[model samples]
Each structure stands twice: as C-alpha cells, then as structure tokens.
Target chain A: MIQGNKKKFNVREIREQFPALRQLIYGKNLIYFDNGATSQKPQMVLDAINLYYSKDNANIHRGVHYMSQQATNGYEDSRRTIQNYLNAEKSEEIIFTKGTTDGINLVAFSYGQLLSAGDEILITAMEHHSNIVPWQMLCERKGCVLKVAPINKKGELIMEAFDALLSKKTKLVAVTHISNALGTINPVKELAKKAHAVGAKILVDGAQSIQHTKIDVQDMNCDFFVFSSHKVFGPTGVGVLYGKEALLEKMPPYQGGGDMILKVTFERTTYNELPYKFEAGTPHIAGVICLAKAIEFLSSYDMEAIQKHEIELAEYAQDMLTTFEGVHIIGEAKKKTSVVSFTVDGLHPFDIGTLLDKQGIAVRTGHHCTQPLMDFYKIPGTIRASFAFYNTKEEIDFFISAVEKSINMLR
Target chain B: MTLEEKQQEIIQDFAIFDDWMEKYEYIIELGKELPIIQADKKTEDRLIIGCQSQVWLDSSLENGKMQFYADSDAIITKGIIGLLIRVLNNETPEDIAKVDLHFIREIGLQEHLSITRSNGLVSMIKKIKMSALMAV
Candidate 1:
C-alpha cells in the first residue's frame, strides 16, 4: 500500500507499480499525460489478470466442477467488490461491460428502444462521442427528438438552457459527469434532479468523473451510471454499468445470448436476472477480476487526500502554463478535473504533441473525440495533459519546461 | 504507381523538411505541391467543418482509382494534407481499405499528430475511402 503522508505518493513508487512507466522514450523516463484516454495498469492489476488466466480459467456459472466454481467465484466476487466501491444498492445492479462505450450503448439499446416518438433525450454540448452518438442513434431510430443543452464560452454548462430544455416530453437525460475534452466537472446531481423533476430518467457517463471523484448513484439520483475500468487504472475491455434494479428489470435485454436467458425454449424464451440480462456470451473475465484489484487499490488511498494532491498539481500546471507567451488554456470552469487543455501560439497542436513526445512527455493532442465541442469552441484542437492521482509536481515542472522549450524551438 | 516508385517520390520530397525550424517556409513549399481546385468548386460542400484551418478536399475517380486534391489555408496543415496525400492518394479502393496506417508510428508521425488532427486525418481517410468505395 502507498503511504498516506504528503510525500509518500512518490513518483518513483507510483511509477514502479506501472512497469510501462519505466519505459524509455527518446532516452528519457516516459511522462505519460494521456490518462484521459486510458490509464496505465499497475502490476497488481496485471498479476490479478495472470492469476486468473493461469489458475482459475474456466467457464463460469454453469459448471459444477472446481475450476468452474473458482471462475464463478472470481467473477461474482468482482461484482460485489464493484458494488461496494460505487456504494451501489445491490450487486445485481452492477453489470459488467466492455467499457464506457459499451455501457452507453447497452442503456441506449435497452432503455432507448422502449421510448416512443415525440419523446425527448437531453444531452449536453460537451459529451464524448460515445455518450452522444448512442443517444443520437437511439433518437434517430425511435423517432425521438434529441435536444442539447448549451454551454458558456468558458465551456461551463449553461444551467438555464438545460432548465429550458427539460419538459414532460423528456424521457431520458444522458450527460457526461465530466467533460473529457474540457475537463469540466458537470453538475450531474443538479442535472439528475432536473431530469427527475420532469419525470425523466437520467444516465451519467461517469468515465472521466469516477477517476477524480467519489460517486454515489443514490446520492446523485441517477438511474444509470457508466464508466470504463481502463480509465481508473484497471485493465482494458472492462467497464461497469450500474442501473437501478427496477430500471434494469423494466428494460429489455441489450443482447441475446446464453447467459442472459433464464431458460432455452423453442417456443418462447425469458431473460435472466438483472446483470446477466445485459451481459451476453462469455464476458471479459480476466479484465473484470483485475478491475476489482484496481478498485481495491483506489479504496486503500484516502480519496480526499489524493484529490487534494491532484488539484495542487493541476493548479501548478495552470500557473506554469500561463507563463508561456503563446499558451492559451481552455476550459476554465470553477469546478474542473486535473485536465489542462492549452494551445501555444504559432505552433499547431500536432506539432506541439510531436515535440512533447520527443521530450518523453505523452499528452493527448487534438479534438479528443469531441468534434462537436471543438466546433463549438472554434479551435482545431488543444494539447491536453490530463493528470492522474499518481502524477507529481516535479513532473508538471518538467512538462512546463518541455513546453517552454518546444514553444521556443517552434518559434 | 508501384510501391517502389511511391517510395522514391516520398524520398525525393522528404528533403523539403531539411530545415525543420523554417516551418513556414516548408509549409509554403507544401502548399505549392497542392493541386488547386477551381474557384467555382470552393463551396461549403468542400469545406471540412471541424478544422480551424480552411481546408477543402475534392475527389474524382479515374480508371477505377480514386484521386484526392486538398488544400488548407494554414500552411502546416497544408503540409499535413500533403503528407496524407502522399500515403493515401492513388491507391485502389481495396488496397486503401486494407491499409492499417499503423506505419504512421514507424515514420514517427502519429506522435506529432494531435488527437484532433489524427481524428481529422481519420475523417479524411474515411471520406476518401467512402468515395473510393462509391467509385468501385
């Protein structure tokens, strides 16, 4: 376990957990700033994956043998672990998915397929394509109207516009809890309340939010919450979709297959229980097991303390970036995550990203899959450096120095 | 064109970046290589909606092959478009469809591409491929 002292979250110790962090890029220690895309997995998560495949590999649930029981136990145990992590009402509410994209698609297909024409689905101006496209597809297919709530010039959500958009016709409200492109921490609780006031169910895309904040679906009053495990230092190909039991039971099964059914019949078939109904075929067993390990790793740390450390790093980065002559920071909302999106004058973002890569700093450059938001902002893209709990202030200094050098070189 | 011929052409053009610091000069040089679209052809139809630079791409099929002509108002973007055209232009629809382009990593270009530029490149590729498929 990492020590709780202020300096105990050493970059060396944190980097040690992620073997990839030691890798040399341009003969320098890799400073990964692309955590917004996907986080690097720790050795513990890797070991969990290896252990599962090496020892406990078997078909889960149906088999009566020892290996089967072990596999089943590992899989179900992960569900319980995640349920506790999210403070979900029950393990049945935790449905394993491929990732945030799959989770959103599942809800859109299941809950969305049920909506009639003239119903409205409200999403915000700043949503990842995964959140926006699925709902758009749903509205397009179901003859429902898709309405967007606007945002301010600062990339903050316009609450009044959101309020005006909400009506009794609004069947479902799907919005991102955190803007992956802008790093804005949205008022999802307020959005949820607004949706529920109009008798509309809400789904919070928690992919970016879950990493930086502690989430309680009950407290937020969101009907569904979706997040990818990869964004939270867990293995790729695994995610969680937490739906209220009543909502899960009410909606149709997302996909048809073996595990999702109660019984096989030539005439008629009934779907299985809450989670299994959404989980079709053989799921990502190893990834799910490792996700539990990641959740365990996060639970060990004091979340408030970690958040404080990250905020400090973010503020330092913001200050350092402001010193650069041509640098412009995007997304200056009062509430934000540890993402800093900036554009340097005269240097294209791609050029900046390339030069940064040479300096062993990995930052995401471009629109970040938020083309609509980019269109709204009227910029091609910004070089984005999103921080994780494991990042350090020294790394930020190195990053700022690199940016300064890069800007100078480009100039 | 044969793969060898394409390689030769790219190698010949690669010297244009000998002085990387003179980016504006290289960008202007890249702009010169870009084939011009007719003034009447300039329309909202040709404008790539997401780019900060005013980029216009137009395509035509000849002898069952797709050909692309693109220009960008921003100089470096023009160079990027030229880079893209070097890789993608004149390929068969089937060949273009199978090209993984993970080789962008080999040439060390992906690291240089911002996610948006990467996405724009992807969107451009997708559009080009769609046009090729239409031609086919």
Candidate 2:
C-alpha cells in the first residue's frame, strides 16, 4: 500500500476505490499526476454506469413504460445533483454538454451570432484553446474585434489590464477561472463584476476551477459558467453549462434537432424551453447518470479537507522540484491550484515526460493546448504535474526522486 | 489506383515512412543536415509563433516545388520540421493541398510525440503548405 501522512482517509482505502490505479506501469505502481486533464473514476462512478446500462437502459422522457420512467428519473436526478453541487438556483439553468469545449462553443455560436461588427470580445492571454478559439471564430465571422487581457510575469492575470480592456463596446468577457496550462487561479469574481459594469456578458470556463476549488456561481454572479464532468472524476462525454435563466431565455438554440425544438412545420418552427433548447439530440445518458455518483463521492469528503491535503502535497512537490539543479517552476502565482509547471534546463519536456513514464509516473508535458502562454514564457513547453485530493505526499516524493534520477541520467 | 499502388508510387518518389521509428532517427539526422539560417534571418518575420521552441521557418518555391529552411533552439523540434519537410517537400501544390497529414497518426507518431512536437509538426506542415499555395 502507498505510505503517507495518515489522515481521516487512508491511502489503501482510497486506492481500493479506483481499480485502474492498482495496475502496474513499467513494473512500478502508477503515480498519476495528470488530474487536471482528466481524473480516474472511482468504483462508485463505474458501478453507476454498469447499473444504468444493465438494468435501467431505456430512452428517456418519451415512453410510459417502467424502464423509461426509471431512466428519465435517474437522468433528471443527476441534473438536480449537479445543480446542488454547483449551488445553482434551479435545474432548468443547467444544460448538459459534451464537455467544456462544447459548452464554450454553444455560448459562442448562440450569443456570439448576435454580435455585430466592431463589437469587442475580451479574453485573457492565459485561457485554454477551448476558451480562445471559439471567440476568435466569433470575431472572424462577426467582424468583431478580439481583445486580450495580458498576464504578468508571475503568470497572474493583470487585473489592471483586464479593467482597461473592458469598454462599452465589449459585448462579452470570456475567461478561464483556472488556467489549464499555468495553474493560475484567476480573480474571476472581480473580473466578472468589471465586465458587467461595462454591460458585457461574462462566460467563466470553470473546467479547471470546479475540480479544485469551491465555486458559488450565485456569488460570482457571472452570466454563464461552464465545466466538464470528466475533470471532476465523473464520466467523459458529459459536462454542464449554467446560464442565468433570463439570458438563456433570450439566446437562440445552438443546434436544430429533435429535442431542441418544441414544434416544427414546413414553414415555421418554435424552440423548446431553456436547457432543453441547448441540449440537442440524444445525450450521454450513462455518463450523466454516473456523474451524479462522482459528485456524491466528492461531497462525502469536505472540500476544505481535500484542499488542505492537496495544498500540502503541492507545496512539498514544489519544494522538492526546486531542489533539482536547473529546474525552474513556471507560473509562480500567489494563488494557484496544485499544478506545478516546470522546465529542466538540459532536457526537453518530451524527454522528461518519456523518462518519467518509464518509472510509472504520468505527468503532462508540452503547451497543454495553450500555445500563446508558451510563447509568453519563451519556452518550448513545460512538464506539468497536477495533483488531486486523492494524490498523496509520498507519491509526490517518489515523483521528485524519479525526476532527479531522470535529470541526472539525461544530463 | 489501389491504396497499395498509390502508396508505392509515392514511396518511389520520396522516402517511405513504413519504418517510422527508423525514419524518426533519419529525420533527426536531417536536422543535422540543415544548413543553419543566418543570424540576420532570425527576425520576427521568420519566427514561427505558437511553438514552444524558438523556431524560425523560411521557404522558397523552386520550379513549382517547395523547399523549406527552418531551425529551432530545441533540437528535437528542429528534427520534427525536418520530418515534416521530408513528407511535404517536392510535392505539387495541389497534391500537398489534398493530403491530410493528420494521417501521421497512422505512422504511430502521434502516440510518441509530445503534444508540442505534434503541434509543431502541424504548424511546420501548414507553413510549408501555405508557402506552396502562395507560390502556386
């Protein structure tokens, strides 16, 4: 069993929950540090999936049969569970999507289609490609101008520049709450408020933030919030987009499909209600049902406890990483999630990632879909070790030791 | 033509990537073959944006075929460009335009490439193709 600081939860107990984590890679226990990309699901989440497929499999919301009612109830219950997890006012505001990318594209296509020429869309330089590309497409199509809020050398958002970027002509401010590449936890509440003051709608890409931090959308008061279920230990192919009821009502449906339309005739068509209008066609029913189980697993553990445990692990990893000669950690922001982005002097990031993988330590390396940020740092790419609540300090120590060995060998 | 026939014809004209691992080594060796771009050409105009490495690419079209001159501060990234040029060079603009180099996945390079290298390969191919289109 993995050894570490003994806490309320033991490593063995936690390890038992994830069957995939038990597998050996390169004859060593897997030390997964790519949580920011996608997390491994626990048995509960997996079981939920199996149960849905085997016992409750049916098309939802249309049939009067028992299986259909059960499936529909399970599906809707998952939506309510997600609503409670996000603390949204109502379930109608939550629209299921494929993932964070789809969520952002939905908003961009629906709301961005309304934007006229000369309208401005403000986004930070630290955003993931998911946040950046959709807006760029909108700008190109609408003849709208795209404005970027730059980050300081420390990889923190330049709040002053963000404020300056907001203007009367700025129609939308789309930013990531937590940067996937840099691990910078942006001051999204303040940024959202500033955008609202300038009469711009705000779309917070909470893909990274929702996994690590406590999010109160009501308190943030952003117009739209988006997150992926996979990043939060749920199933892939499912995500959430929480839009305020008033704004969702005004926006047109993104895709013209069976579920999104209320009535269709030869000449005229009327759209469905708010969330359904956004959710087109058959959804990822099994993934959605299993997402609720993942949420339940997360809710059982106090967030503060999880944050405390992860912060300790991150700090330990950072200290150990700094001890290696010629190792420089990128994005030294005062506020960050448990992600350490670093570059070794003599070795390329790819070489480092490959070497580490040989020892069963999995870390993400490269631009991480944020080429613009890599350009700012003036580096080829970084080796990113992102942590989750389940990751232990001993695993981080093993990671550090492996890195030292790899660097020594490579050099 | 059949897939095999088309592949054989292409293979006859250019080096086949059938042994991609060996080809990778050859590509890296080709990075060594590249004549260094002059310090004067390392200006903003030659700089390839969105690369993790400080890469500068410049190309000239001769007799309707593209020849690329590229360098990167990172050796492996430079090697990636060499590999890209090997596939992309000597092809007509129309042929290059028709090829979906995303089929690099078939060579099993995607699984091996770091995301940056994958992206760099993409950019390098795009720049070379765009240069070809411009020449045409």
Candidate 3:
C-alpha cells in the first residue's frame, strides 16, 4: 500500500504506520529510543504475520498441497526481496538463519572447515561479542590465530593499526559495518579492498548498518554480509546471510537435516543445492513472509530522508546532553548514526536508567554486550538513547527533560 | 517495631505518594542516606551475582539476631537495599528465612523482585535467607 504522498517525506505519516508508537506507558506517551536493539514493526508486517499463520501456514519446499506452495512462494519471494535490497547478484546467495549470530556461526563452522592451522582471522576492537566470539571459537577448533586491530579513544578504527594487522597469513577479516555500542560507521568498502589486496575475504556484520543505510554487496565487494530482520522493523527469529556465490558453493553445508539433503543412503549422502544446503529444519515461515512485508514497508519511504532524520535526532540529543555539567559523550566519531551514549560524573547508569523508567522514557543502560569496549573506556556502562526514523524532535525534547529530571533525582 | 509492623509502616509511607515521582524522590533520598559498608567487608565473596549494579551484602549473627549491611554502585539499588535491611535487620534467623517480602510488591516496586531483573536484589534476598538458614 502506497502511503500516497511520496513527494515529501512525512515522519508523522510514517509514524502512523507503526501501532506500537501510538501508546501510553505509565500514563505518558511512550518515547521509545531503543531502536539500536530492535525496531518496532509496522502494521503491515504484523498483519502479514497473522495472515500467513492463519491462512497460508504449511511446511515449505517439499509439499504438493496448495497451502504449501503458497507458503513456499511467499518465503522465496521474501528471499528475492532481500536479494534486491542488498543488490546481491543471485537469490541463491541469500541464506536464511535464526538471526545475525546464527549467520556468523554458520560461516565460522562451515567456512572454518576449509582453513588449516596457522591461518589468521583479523577483527576490530569495537566488534560486538557476537562477531568476536565466533572467530575465537573457530580459532580454538581449527588452530587459527585471532588478531585484533585497535580503535582510537574516539571509537573510530585506527586505519594504521588495521593495515598493520592485515597480512598474507590473514585468511578472513570479520568486522561490523557499524558499532552497536558506539554508533561508529566503519569504512567497510575500503576495508574490503584492503582485505582483498592481502588475499583475505571480508565478512561485513550488517546487524547495525542494514536498517540505517543502503547496502550493495557487489558495490562494497564484501565476500559475506549478514543482518537480522528484527532490527529492520520485522519479526524476530529470522536473519539473512548474503555470501558470494562462489564462496558459498565452496563451503560445506552448515547443518544436515531433512531439507538440506538431496538424498541420504546408508553408504553415502549428498547435500542439497546452494540455499537449501544451509537451511536445516522447517524455518520460521511466518517470520520470513512478514519480513518481506517489512522490507516492502521500508521501500515505500525515501531511505535518504530516514537516514537524515535519524542523524538529526542523534546530533540534537548529543548536543543537548553536552550542555549538562558532567555528561560525557562516549563515542564522537566523524560519521555516526542514531546513537548517543554518555556517562555522568558521580552517577551510575543504572540509577539514571531507573529514574527515566518512572517518567515513561525507554532507554538502554548497561554494558550493551560490549564489555571489552566498556573496559577500554574505563567505565562500567553508559546510558544510551538510540533513535529510529519514526522518532521526532518532540520526543527528543521530552527525553532531554526526562534526563535532566533523572539526573537531579540521582544526584 | 515487629517485622510485620515495619512492613505495614513502609506500605503506609508509600501510600501517601500520589505518583511515581514522589515515591522515587523518597527512594533516592533513602539511597543517599544509606550507610556505606566498611571498606574491609567489600570483598569479592560478598558480591551479589545477578544485578546490573554491583551490590555487596554482608551479614552477621549477633546475639541470635541478624545484622545486614549492604552497598551498591547505583543509588536506586542502594535505596532498595535500604528497604530490605530496614525490615530484616535485627530479626531472628528463622524469621529472616521464613518471612515473605510482600512489602516489595505491596509498595509497587515489584519489578526489582522479578527473576529477570539483573539488579541482583533477588540474589541478595536469597543470600540473606541462606545465611539466616545457616545461622538457624
């Protein structure tokens, strides 16, 4: 459904599409600023979820019944939608999994099989634990060496250090396109070029970048890209892994199950073709179909406008936060998305967070699953307010006042 | 006051507040007034396991009565700890172990009591009970 006035981007109209945005929390209008964790679903996606389970529910890929075929078509069409979104050359390269963590593990377990001892995997200091732990586990299992590139105090990757770390021994360079805890957008395209120069393949963890920017795997020349549907206004339990066709064909199947087998015999077993080789059980069918609706919902708006709006919100919040006496902004990268993390002198993040909760403003406060980054900053945790496109300056205004009140109460 | 009487008194104090603001303001004040734990008692063994804030709780049995002291990095958690100690301090070990902390829920601060809340108050309460049981 076209929202009908595409000429000018109207955030209010876009906000209307999300039912969760129109509600009350503790008698105040809910000001949700936790988008970096997950996004609220548009009504279209919610409706699609209900429609799929109510009408078209069936096991996909092997049944000859009408419902099964319809379910299969919806699931495949969703793959094509994601393929077009990421500009992958073929739909066969899109492998659906549980989410970003699952996608990274698939590469670690399957692609790790091809690596021999003494091979190296290079990652950055700012990667989320999901990206770091998989490589460590792979190293433990395969005897590959794990190397980390340093980031400056500003939370930006030190290109000199990254360059020094990349060598011929490096077989894989796994990094996040954007930092979840710091809102730092890494130079993935440049990093990809450098990795290729060293004869190493790069995997871009797009968990934070997919919703905020345009992604073209071919344009970026990344060997692998992964993102979660829930972070892009879709349902949870579904994710996409976009790998180069040649690389995917070379890697062994991730999981062996009913759908991932071409034929099984007592003597020998052959794996199914490209995409199916990775998808094991009956997948999250309703979630996949609803994710397509989410992508469609996102496609209706101007992504550039959304990106601009989100950046404006973050900048506005950061500038307001800076005016306060003891508020210290954590990440001040040259290019950042919709995240403002900070610490206050003589105040704990958990205290501030609890005070904000009483006032009906939702923000995340903790280590944010980046303990190494927290330790680098020499702080326990931070109070983070991450915005989405549907948010407005009005919500930021309320959030700022809430923060002030919370600080006063905390002090 | 008896333990049940102390709980009733706290409930009455909270009932006077019209909204969450007034209640939180009082809690923050209580948190600010919470006594600091002795430096020597802040050992790793006394640290609670599940809270987002680091909470150290120490207890002793003096003359068959329970004596509890606690501290936290967060003021709100400190205030909540103040409430817990107010009711349980100086009670008998059997009473400390057997008493239901209904006052937490009665005062509309039940979120902290939830098992999913990582603030470690639940763990602190459990530890207090385990200590009380040991003393018994």
Candidate 4:
C-alpha cells in the first residue's frame, strides 16, 4: 500500500524536513550517521507529537467523553495505520510496546510456556542482546536448550549450520533480520520456512530491518516480528509486535493493567482480547500517535527508492573506508544494509569516536549490544556509521575526510 | 602542591586551549604520559566494569599516602584517569577522599561528564575514595 506514484528523492528537500539536522555541531555542519541506533525525526513527526499533547490529550481506550473518544480513535487509528504499514491481516494482531526490548520480553513471557525440558530454541551469533537474552531467560525458566547458529567469516548466517540445528526438538528460532553491529541481512524468509518445517516457530527481530527494508509478514510467513518506531524516525518508547492470529489467540495476556482486562473482581478477573491484552496500562499514547505520523511520512515516499539510496550510500562509504591503510571493515556480508562498521589498526574505536565527535560526525562505537559477535571477530569494538535516505554523497565525502584526519591524529 | 592547588593548576593549564581539538590533543598527550600500571596488577579484579571502554585501576596505600596506577583500552578514558591521578596521587587518604574534582568542569572536559562517560568517571572517583576509605 505504501508503493505509489512517487517523486525522485531530493536530499535537499528531505534534509529540510528535519530541523535538528539544520544546526551546527562544534563549528562544523552536523553529519549524523547513527541511523542504526536511532534516526532523527521529521518536522511532521514533531508537529504530530505536539498536536497530540496540545489538542488530543487523553488516555486511550478508557473514556466515553468527546476528547477521550477522539484520543481512543486516534490511538486505534494508529494501530490501523501500522497494521496497513506492515500489511498484517488485522489490526488485532498488532501490539504496541515500549520498544524492541520490551516487545521481546513480552513474547518470551507469553510464549515461554510452550517450551518444555530438552526443547531447543535456536538463535544466532549476530543477535542483539535483546533477541538473545529473553530466550536465554526462557530456557533457564523452562529447562529448555538454547542453541546458537554460527555465522561465516563474512558475518552471514550459515544456512547449512542452521539447517543442521533444526530438528523435532527445536521449538523456536529467534534471529535478527539485520545485525545491528554487523549490518548483515539474514535470509529470514527462507529461515522462517526451514523453522516451520521442524515444527518450530520463528521470530524475526525487525529492530534494524524495519526501517531499512520493506516487511510483509504474510509473504515471509514468520510466526512473529518485532520492531521499534524510533529507529524508523518516530519517537522513542514506541514499538510494534506482530503475531499471527492463531498463535496470539492461544497465548495468554502479556501484562496486567487497566485496559488489558475485561473485568477485575476479587472473585474472578478475565483478560481482554488480542492486541489490547498484550498492550498494558496508559501506553505511550502521544508517542504511538506520533509514530503513526512518522509512518505516514515514510509512506509518502517510495520505500524501495529510499532503500536503494541508503544502500548506495553505504556501499560508497564502505568503498572509501576500505582504501584507508590498516582500516578493517567488519561484516562483509553478500547482502547488507546501510551500515559500515570498521576499526583502524592500533586505535581504539572510542578514540576515533571521540575525535569524530569533536568534528561533529556522529557515529556509534561499542560492542553495540552484540558482545558475542565482537568476541568472534577477536576485537573489543568497531566504529559504525549507519545511513538514512536523507543522507547525501556530499556528507559521505565529508565523513571520509574527517575519518582519515581522525585516524592520522590517533596514529 | 596541595590537592586543591593541583586541581587549580590543571584548571589554569586547560584554559589556554582555544577549542576542543587542542584540549583533546593535550588530553591524548596526558594519556600517553600516564604512569604505567604493573602488568601483574592488570588482572580482572582490578578491571572496572560498567565502562564502555575497558579500564583497569590499581591502588596502593603506603605510609598513609595513596597512589593510583591505571590504564584503559581507550586513550580518552586513560587521559581522564590521568587527569584524576595527577591531582590525587601521593596525597594522604583523607586529603584525596575530601577533595572535590572541580578541575574536570573547570577544564571544560564536558564529554567526561556526559551520561555515557559519567558512569566510568564516577566509578573511578568512587574507587579512589574506596581505596582511601579502606586505609582509614
């Protein structure tokens, strides 16, 4: 539905939309390449957030008054907007969460009961701690086995190894669609199919992929998917969890609170239906509404065109970084997203990151919550520059020059 | 110099740098000049957790004077520790414990005060005081 008659992306026009990007940092034009961590919000999103609190300021799903009705309608309309965005079969399957971390925890708790002793839950070496830890906790609680699928030297998941791990005992396979640290895109659709063959459910961690690529849950046939809105240029504390109807209908409610209940009596309290049962309490009402606005902003453009632009930028940056003497770019996957992670020889990522900060170049340098991946690569951490469509080749040229200068100083 | 005098000296020393770049170069120079931590003392127990960059700090209290030997995987962190060490080293535990590290702010090392680096900085200060507290 997002695909339609679209104009060619104008980096100048798009850059104008984000007011934060218009400012200066340390006497240099701000060059933000931390999109993998979080993207800057467009003016439309900021305006929407302001509009919500200023005009429609009421808790959703609880009031019968006009303002409350309007608020509730806006909130549900957000769910429908997102439902259309992800192309989920029904709005009932979409659950709002605090972020990717909270979404994973909810699934871990709600679905943990399905696994028993000796049941194997599969994950990958490339998962963020969010995707890995919840299953680790679930395995600990239920006496299940947690198996990690290994990756190749190029940071791609080994499909043969993954196939070997899947069997009758394999109860679930949870993996990231794109590695936050490595930027390696997993063949999630094929993996999802393989997971189902062994009677195991699969979960695609869409935290990185949701913003960079298009998602069709039906076409992919994954059992569940989770993503954060903030990474896609929306506000923080807002995330989405998409679960198939049959599975969600079977699972119990995630949290106990005001709106998640049908009735609360001392004698007996029953839970509400799907989606609402998963979403607890007075949610990030304003954040979700603004998130829908962000999605609306995204839908205005051709996502395919945006994705292509981002990929080209990343490729160009990667090519430039490779030419630097003693510079190593991590995760050379055959298929990747708009992220280039690298480390200079004999220089800590922290030092490079600090120097880059002085020059107003924003990049993330750490284990990126994927410490296992770092251990595999035999490094402490790498400097990551992630791109968004709003970025331009001119910015990349400036980034390369800054990085080269920073490296020379550190050396 | 007294601990306050030393901190004041550093504050005065950093005021000459016109921009962040020069100030950073000075910090990096300080990092390079940090007293070497004994290789044996660089064990896991001496390692400071909760830091984005790995840090190892060791303390020795002899004849009521405290000495801190530290190293970091990141140069900026090492430089930060060097700044702390310059002021606190060779002072009495009570003096080290009581002194406020005002030079950090006065020198405009605002990046060290940021949320990401603040944990490491605070822990370093706490460990310094803890080493002093143990001797007392």
lDDT of 3 by residue, A1-411 (tens): 344643357888889989998988888899999898999999999889889988999999999999999999999999999999899999999999999999999999999999999999999989889999999999999999999999999999999999999999999999999999999999999999999999999999999998999899999999999999999999999999999999999999988888999999999999999899999889999988888888888877778888999999999999999899999999989988899999999999988988788888888898888888998999989999999888999999999999999888787
All candidates: TM-score: 0.83, 0.80, 0.97, 0.97
Angstrom error of the Cα, residue A99, model 4: value is 1.3
Candidate 1 lDDT tens digits, A1-411? 446533344546666788888788867779989999989988899899889889999999799999999989999999999998888999999999999999999999999878999999999999899988998899889999999999998889999998999999999999999999888999888888889999999999999988899998889989999999999999988999999999898999988997999988899998898889888899998889889999887777777877888888888999999987878888999999899998877666866676677688999987888989988978778899999987888889899988887676555
CA lDDT, candidate 3, residue A82: 92
DockQ values for all predictions? 0.14, 0.14, 0.78, 0.66
**Docking quality (DockQ) of candidate 4:** 0.66
For model 3, the docking class works out as medium
lDDT of each: 0.82, 0.81, 0.92, 0.88
Q: Which of the predicted structures, 3 or 4, would earn the higher DockQ when compared with the native?
A: 3
Question: Which ten contiguous residues of candidate 3 chain A have the minimum total lDDT?
Answer: A1-10
Of all native A–B interface contacts, model 2 reproduces a fraction of: 0.13
Q: Would you list the rank order by TM-score, best first?
A: 3, 4, 1, 2
Tens digits of per-residue lDDT for model 2, B108-128? 456434554443555666676
Decreasing lDDT order of the candidates? 3, 4, 1, 2
| Fnat of candidates, each listed | 0.00, 0.13, 0.83, 0.48
The CAPRI classification for model 1 reads as incorrect
**Model 2 clashing residue pairs (backbone):** A380-B52
Sorting all predicted structures by DockQ, with the top scorer first, yields 3, 4, 1, 2
TM-score of chain A of each: 0.97, 0.97, 0.98, 0.98
Those runs of model 1 whose alpha carbons end farther than 4 Å from true positions after fitting are A1-8, B1-70, B73-77, B80-136
Pick the winner on TM-score between candidates 2 and 3: 3
Question: Per-residue CA lDDT of candidate 3, range B14-118, in tens?
Answer: 999999989989988999998758889989999885536888999999999999999988888889999999999999999998999899999999998786568
